[model samples]
Target chain A: MEPLFLEGKEDTPKIILNSQSNQYLISGRSLPEDATSFYSPVLKWLDEFSTQTVADPNVKFEVRLEYFNTASSKLLLDIFSKLEGLSENGKKVTVQWYYSEDDEDMLEAGEEYSELVDLKFEMKTY
Target chain B: MENNEILTKSMIYDLFKEMTKENITLLYQGDFSQNLMKAILGLTEKKMDNIEVSTNVKKKVFNVLVECVQNISKHSDESKEPPASKFTSILMLGSVNDQFIISTGNLIENKKVESFKSKILMINSLTSEGLKNLYKKIIVGHSLDEKGGIGLGLVHIARKTGEKFEYRFDKIDEQYSYFTLKVNISKIK
Candidate 1:
């Protein structure tokens, strides 16, 4: 499968979904004016990735967003929902949610996502 | 009144004095576009950086500002013809002691005012846990509107700030009303 990489900008997050290299990450700030359009390709790539055979038995998705607006929050849920599907398909999937030590909001956000999604989430603070 | 005297120096000075008294760090009134929104965020980030606010406070301020500005840009009503003033929306960012205040106003159709007000009221009525539950429910179940809004911005804002929103609606004409919303974020964690 082809790797997906989107460079982060002032308002958008960088996304890396490379199954070949086992590197899946979505980080940086996410506050695009049109988040739906901004994340459409990402959702599409995930859909494509799910259909393919899993080379590795374990997948660790990393989320290190500094900040994301509410619209992007919804999209993040969608992304997690897709990940849940992968987990149900017998692949061990884990979400590494990283936040700054002082960012309680980000920590709470990760906790909320953990509750909403079925996958195992590891909360790491730097 | 001559055009030059319309905005007299004394009047400008008075306005400046008022803004200073109010601790307003930024004020803008005009049409809002996506590019302008980006610029506003960038400028506010710089200002916050200069002030050396804590990382958490800065994140909260930036988050609230993004939602408010985007709401104005996306949902604000537009007239069929251009209005004379051309300042259809206004945004003000200020700091008072330990709190950051974000205020935004925009035109909206009068018919939608009741529903908009009710939505805000409902959100304000929720407790922190309730707001969190509502946010999760909406995010998990609701689809984005045609404008890509899932109607979660206000809920998210309420959850983040843990403060009730202050909002007002002023009748502009038979068809339109000016809607204003104010949010406050405490710098102290």
Candidate 2:
């Protein structure tokens, strides 16, 4: 329905969803004080998007997270699983995982997430 | 002494700066009563890569470090002080010659020593591909701890580093043990 956007923090990442453009972006560090509270809404938004998505929706999900803790990694997995499920059900999903050229850990993180899910993922080095 | 603590972290920074020009100085999951462990990991990952390095070396270090930190976060639980106190654990990312090292330390439960030893022994024996296969098996076999299972972390550490993870479980009390594990980050030839 409406746009869903949450800003990133010095310790947390920003989440932006453009329902109109069929584009979603999650960027920054993710170690929220309360992980469940932080991720539940994002999951909810994705669920809603799946239902009210635009015609011929080719969703572009960009992840440029500098870091995420183990707990947040689980949350990201949950989100990707959902996206994977949506894609499996014949929705268009393209994921771009961004990392600085020097950030090996971040790149490997993207690789781990890619391994765990079945989405169209492109690991981009900035 | 309270104010002096800040100097230790600063000194650590200086030491790391001198150790290598790579700037891989992140410490995690120590002493803060809350979620300091996660904070440390979050901060470190932001800068844990060296773009100048090859993809193979980069992947090797990244995987080892993740395993090391996850082990620290999941098992070690020594808070600093005053009952609900914060504690300090140190992680140093540096190179000895050309090989990178990920060192981590935290408090442990004395009783878990045997389990820790066995896991290390088991992990050190596997080849990289074997470790990967084992990880997949664990995932499919539903092997998980109450929080999140780090069974795979050890295997990944062993395989990625191509070296035994050096760990010392020092006894603090009958109930507590201090454990430190170091993983070497050199791609296996």
Candidate 3:
């Protein structure tokens, strides 16, 4: 399946995922107008992606966000966990987290995740 | 500070800082996070600063602000003081030269501010790729605080701004302090 992409609004984040490139990305500020509706499809895609993955697949994803609401934050946890499963099951799932040059909050966000799990992650800049 | 002086302060820039008409100064309350956010987006687009904002920066600032606001709306019930409990927060969007500052004030205990500070500092030290990995780790371990955020809320605050997360703690009463978070949103090139 092709990755999902949605244009972000003032209250939502722009989401783009390409299953072919295996380069999934959820970027932009993600304080969605309705948290449930916005993230539901994204979560759905990830679920499908996981089940459809071939053995020994290489799945790459990037999440570059500066802001997300509490509800959306829960969804991020969900997204990361799903990707983690994919990685553990003999797949090369690389996650690239991009932030600003001096964004301490985003950096710490990455660190918190790192401390929480044993998996390795790539923190980057654009 | 007399009543007359306080009354005069309502004339826009009367809040200690000089402000132009384009600058935004507003307080947010109720369960109106979405409506407030929509209004903010319109203001941001209508007034582009000197720097070009890539879509990335725009998303970060907007997303984070909305989350912070919603947090106030959600957690207000926990407030012990009746008056302070009802007051949501002060959110302002203003600029100095080419720099745009988004500042928010909310009631939080002293310790939370310390944690918030350290978290931002840690995130500030990493590369974007490293942050990505960290995001995953937090998810699996469930390291997020109970109130909200995956701990990366502050992380995203730092990452999006490309600047430090400037904060201040003012003791409101014997119990809580008004925490303020500020960031600069540079225009994308």
Off by over 4 Å in 1: B1-3, B81-87, B146-150
Total clashing pairs for each candidate: 0, 11, 39
lDDT of 3 by residue, A40-85 (tens): 8888887777777564377667788866665676677667777777
Which digits, one per residue and each the tens of the lDDT, describe model 1 over residues B11-123?
98898899999999888988677788889989988888888678998999889988888888888887664451344889999999989999998888889999999989999
TM-score of each: 0.94, 0.66, 0.57
Query: Model 1 in CAPRI terms: which quality?
Result: medium
- Each candidate's DockQ score against the native complex? 0.71, 0.10, 0.26
* lDDT tens readout by residue for model 3, B108-170: 765566776677668768786766566555545564353255264555455455566677777
Evaluate fnat for each of the predicted models and list the values in order.
Answer: 0.82, 0.00, 0.44
Tens digit of lDDT per residue, candidate 1, span A1-126?
A: 899999999889999999889999999999988888999999999898888787786999999999999888888988999999986677788999999999999999999999998989999987
Best by DockQ: 1
RMSD of each: 2.0, 6.4, 7.2
Residue-level lDDT of model 2, residues B1-189, one tens digit each, is: 567854666797676676557634554444532355455545544544533456556545654555565566556666444332334566766566567677877776667788878877788777777776675555434522422455655765665566777878877765666777877776332
Better of 1 and 2 by DockQ: 1
Off by over 4 Å in 2: A31-37, A88-90, A99-115, A123-125, B1-30, B33-74, B78-95, B134-147, B152-162, B186-189
Q: Quote fnat for model 1.
A: 0.82
On a 0 to 1 DockQ scale, where is model 1?
0.71
- How high is the lDDT of residue B166 in model 3? 76
**Greater-DockQ candidate between 2 and 3:** 3
